[model samples]
Target: MKNRLMITAITLLTAMLLLAGCGGQESSNVASDESGNKTEKDSGKPKVAVVLKGLDQEYFKLAEKGAKQAFKDLGVDGTFLAATTQTETEKLINILEDLINEDPDALVVMPSTEAAIPVLERYREKDIPVILIDTDLKWDGKTTYIGTDNYTAGQEAGKFLAEKLSKGDEIAILEGVLGTDVNEQRVKGVEDVMKEKGIKITASQAADFDRVKAVTVMENILTANPNIKGIFTANDEMAIGALKAVKARNLNIPIIGIDGTSDVLESISKGEVTASVAQEPYDMAYKGVENALKVLKGETVEKSIDSSIEVITKENAGEKLEEVKSILDK
Candidate 1:
């Protein structure tokens, strides 16, 4: 009888132990679910990634500042990436691929080339929204485009030049990198306006948007057309280069450039560069992040966002320079 009682006790003890173990596991699972809920709530804030063309340029640096400000204001996590050189398409593609792997809530990109379009398509397949800034691509998958109206800005530059020079005055154009939408649209606007004004385009050449290349191309153009009255460069970098070439030759001619970079504004102050079509890169970046957040929240956004542009000349260079400096300092 004692042996039978001992065996029954052992069985009861075993059943109790098994029941306790099962109860402990259920409690642990409940705790795990609670922890997961906390994590989900904490991670509710959207994360955005911004990829620029190149960070070496002052214009992009300002845009970066603006994007940082947007992060601060909107309380979202933001990452910025860029290529070392504007022409480094392969490098840009690699950077973007890495960004895609990160699986951010949204992407803001300044495409270095149209080749970036296919790489960005990967994001679309994953349902990630993309906002394009500064430069544009020929892709239909972009969420929205935020930057200056290049064609209209170029028209403003052309009109400014045409008013200063006579109808028959010969001028030269220092074009940016060939085949890019920014270059093509700006050049087209200039050509249309110059044609309407009866301005003779004595020489036109691509400088690849490099200062050194601009110097060489300007020299060649001057050698062919010595009597060129004025020059219009696609961007401030090329404008600075063209100015260097003209200064070396001891020639005084009106030179207009786009993008009112600090260096270009200082040149304008010194009466070296005639004028520039000032683009609000900072505004573009800030708004781009804002739009990205909106899209992530399933809110409606505009298909196109123009940050606006202005004409900066010696008369307003000091004021504009101060404004730009303030933004960069922030």
Candidate 2:
């Protein structure tokens, strides 16, 4: 009887431990489900994946910061990532594929080129929402687009140049990658206006938007065309590089660029660059995430959100910069 009692106690203890383990497992699963459903309380917020062209550019870095702030305010996850090169078509495809598999509710991407439509279609096939920034694909698979008006911004830059110059001034253009819409549009806009005013382009070269490359290319162009009166760049990093080359040569040509980064604005204030076309990158990031959240909630939003642009010259650079700082503070 003693042996039988001891065996019975052992069996009861085993059963109690098994029950406790099962209870603990069930509780853990329940907690996970609860956490997942928190966004469903009233205004549901969805996750956003921000895939940029590359991390080396100051413009993209600021964009990521703005996206992070928006995510915090809306209580959603904003996963920020970048490709090694802006033109890495395969890398972007793979990143999007993995992100889609994880089932993030939405994606925001700066399309590497107009040629990335086929990959974007795959995401559309999976019913994953997409937001395009900085650049866009030709096809319309994306849920919405948020970016600067590149053509108009370029036009403003052109106007600034026209005002700064007299008739028949020779200018050189340092272009970004050719096929990308941002580069193409901005270049065309400037050329269209400059040509209308009879401003002749002595040299046009593609720096591929790389700063170091821009410096070398600018140096070579300076060797070939020492009489260039004005220089226009597609982005600020390249603009800075060109400025360095110009300063090294002690040339006093007016230089202008796009993407109003802090460094570029500072350069404008210090007369390193003549001007820049300022795009609302922060607004693009904040609104892109906000729109993604709305889409995941099954709400209808505009297919495109256009942020305005401005021409930042030395005259208004200080006031405009102060205004931007105030906006960022809020």
TM-scores vs. true structure, each candidate: 0.86, 0.83
Cα lDDT, model 2, residue 162: 81
lDDT of each: 0.87, 0.80
lDDT by residue for model 1 over 1-330, one digit each (tens)?
Answer: 999999999999999999998877654222111112312213556778888888777888888888878877897766777898788888999999987876888999988779888889999999999999988777899999999889998899999999889988999999988888999899888899999999999888999888889999999999899999999999999999999999999999999999999989999999999999999989888999999999988998888888898999999999999999998773
Candidate 1 segments exceeding 4 Å error? 1-44
lDDT tens per residue, model 2, 133-198: 777567778898889878887888888888878789888899998878899898999999898999
lDDT of 1 at 23: 78
Give the clashing residue pairs of candidate 1, or none. none
User: In model 2, where is the ten-residue run with the lowest total lDDT?
Assistant: 28-37
Cα RMSD of all models vs. native, in order, equals 10.0, 5.9
**Which whole-number lDDT from 0 to 100 does residue 280 have in model 1?**
91
Where does candidate 2 stray beyond 4 Å? 1-45, 319-330
